[model samples]
Target: MRLTELPRTTSFRLALMFLALFGTCSLLLFAFVYWQTVGYMRRDQDEFLQRQLTFYSTLSPADRVQRLREHPRNDPGTRRPSGEFAANGQWLVGNLSVLPAELRQAHQPVDFVLPSAGAPVPFRGYATQLPDGHWLAVSQNVHEPREFEALLLRAMLSAGLLTLLFGLAGAVALGASSMRRIDAITLAIRRIVNGALTERLPVQGGSDDLNRLTREVNGMLDDLERLVHEVKGVCDGIAHDLRTPLTRVLGGLERAQRRASTVEEFRDAAARATEEIAALLKTFNALLRISELEAGARRAGFSDVALAQVLADVVDLYQPLAEEKNLTLQLSGTASPTDITLWGDASLLFDACANLIDNAIKFVPAGGHIEVRLDAEHRAISVTDNGPGIPASERKAVLNRFHRNEPSRSTPGNGLGLSLVAVIAHLHDMKIDITDAAPGCRVSLSWSAR
Candidate 1:
């Protein structure tokens, strides 16, 4: 904004550079015009002087002498001076009282100093022999053209100065505006870097390049805020879930050490303690797997995988488990494996779909209906069950680490099945949607090849 800072901006520097280029071009153009104009004026003067001498030479000596008697200098428009003198360099009968020293030995057009103005002046003249054996001289005035040249020079100089002033003012205004915007962006980013997660850059609602950059930066901030919240939730869940199990294990071990007297009593406590420890390890491993998937490394090994085949395999893997639980498991979709092919990591997709089916079978009541449907035409796979469906408010929450609905708390799970499925779906550029299926829930994962 200050004069000292203006020179440091790119806009100001570019303005100055363009102005210099334009000024140089203007100067060269004026110089050329001046030179050509002067040359033309001098040529016209020489022609006028030669014409006067030729016209006078055609006259008789008496007429020539009579013409010389006229005071030619008295006519301002033609300042042509005429003179005749005995070849003795004496005073002549003309407005030019004396011949310039530089012109004494030559008949060419020349310039001489004016004693009245004390300045050099231009004139073109001719010297010729008269019939009386004397010298005759005539000159054409050149001052008018020279005066015109001076006036042109002054006009151009004033206009150039004005143009320079206006251009500089405009450049300064533009540079200041640009610098102010840049300064604002810098300050906003600094605040964000200082842990102000909710802070956002301002958008002017224009399609300028800087506005687009600001929008992109704001988008990144939004993602950062979401990710920070997710991490915080995961940490809190870890501390809360692991603490109870860990305390129970410690209490069981302590009891065995102090009260157990027989080997059978010690064995029972040890088995219970081992089960709690196994659960802790399982929770840790599931968290690690979700982190790995979200980190986006699994997609690197993606290949063409048929969704129908994955569904069938999931149904097969969980059928026996469903039978043991007395739940009716059914696979109803494309019978052929070649119906719908998806571009993704096959193993990851298999695992994700397996979790979905497993989740459905676990929650469904005895003899309840469980179905895996694959829509080859739409490239969608959904798992539905007649279990206590998740509430609309809790559907989204169930996709987070260790987030369990009230109905799922009694089930033997760490609340990471759907979370892992969400991670895998994201890595494959897929979308996971959960909706109420009448008396139960329907979970569907859909995607395109790209």
Candidate 2:
């Protein structure tokens, strides 16, 4: 960021705007003070003149003349002076030499300048016509008030200049700070674009608006990085998982073409190939279903669903398989089936619960007890199996697509069952918890009732 670009920044521009507003207000305040001060000084001077005029008016003519003649001697400074003048404009007695032509009205205050030594001195005064047709004027020299006005103006100007300097400095500082943060963010974004997936925006640790925005962007970057890694993992999983089935299908077909002379033998080979193809198709379909669920494509199909009913249905669907494996499958809950309900897609919820029960049947040993438990108050359903439970470390990994536990490698599955369940739970705004069932594993899905 260059100095030339500083003014273009929003922070700098706003600072300048506020500074201008403050300067304007200060100027108005100074003007008002100046006006009031000058008016008060002028009024005070005029009042003094009026008081002098009244004192002279109460005196006899002889005494008035004596006081007027003695005024310059009694007040050697001559800051305030009185004078008597004839109607013809001739100065009679006092410090003043002649009647001011500016004082045309009687008993009215006026401002005029008189030659004092070699300089012209400003005065405020009032003149009154006596019965003898002579003018008596009382005045005060206003050099101090005028000097005070000039001093006040200079002080105001100095203060204004200082304020402007400081304000400009502050604005520049603020603009520079903003520019630095923006530059850091831009650099981070460029790094991310250049494939530094872990790059994040800088945080100043302040709770200011800019810092808050940076934190949010960094959080988004964190999510983006996680998604990128997940996508890479998914692609790898697809390639690895599909290669075996596709190879088996191709190898079986080639074997049947080259060596299977008898129809029965050919039919056997064809059947094996068909099975591999079917398994491939099932895996692909499961992947698609998980994708659809993750994208919330089935949200429009959501309706109020009973948790206990879904658990019972899942247990019923998987009970025969559990029995075939010499396992016991039971549906149990603390509340009535009708009472534990939530808003969700019924089919998706059923499929999710079925997946949990199916996984339990697959993993649990012979004569293992599997229970589908529902909690009405928490709007939750849990499937627990008394078999070798999933390892604590692999619990979260099993939720990812195509993730299979080491011990379950020989099991008949594409490894998408729990992933599908996870997607379904997420789509319904439910939380899935995999916990220890004491003797085995417990997988629970819970939601907040709206």
In model 2, pairs of residues that clash are none
Off by over 4 Å in 1: 1-6, 9-76, 79-163, 207-212, 255-262, 321-343, 360-399, 405-408, 431-450
Q: 330-438 in candidate 1: lDDT tens per residue?
A: 8887646465788888899999999998888878889899988887666678899989999999998889888878643667787899999999999888899999999
Candidate 2 ranges beyond 4 A from true positions: 54-63, 66-77, 88-90, 93-101, 104-122, 334-337, 437-439
Q: What is the C-alpha lDDT of each candidate?
A: 0.82, 0.86
Worst 10-residue stretch by lDDT in candidate 2?
A: 98-107
Model 2 vs. true fold: TM: 0.87
Task: Give all candidate RMSDs, comma-separated.
Answer: 5.5, 3.1
Q: Give me the overall lDDT of model 2.
A: 0.86
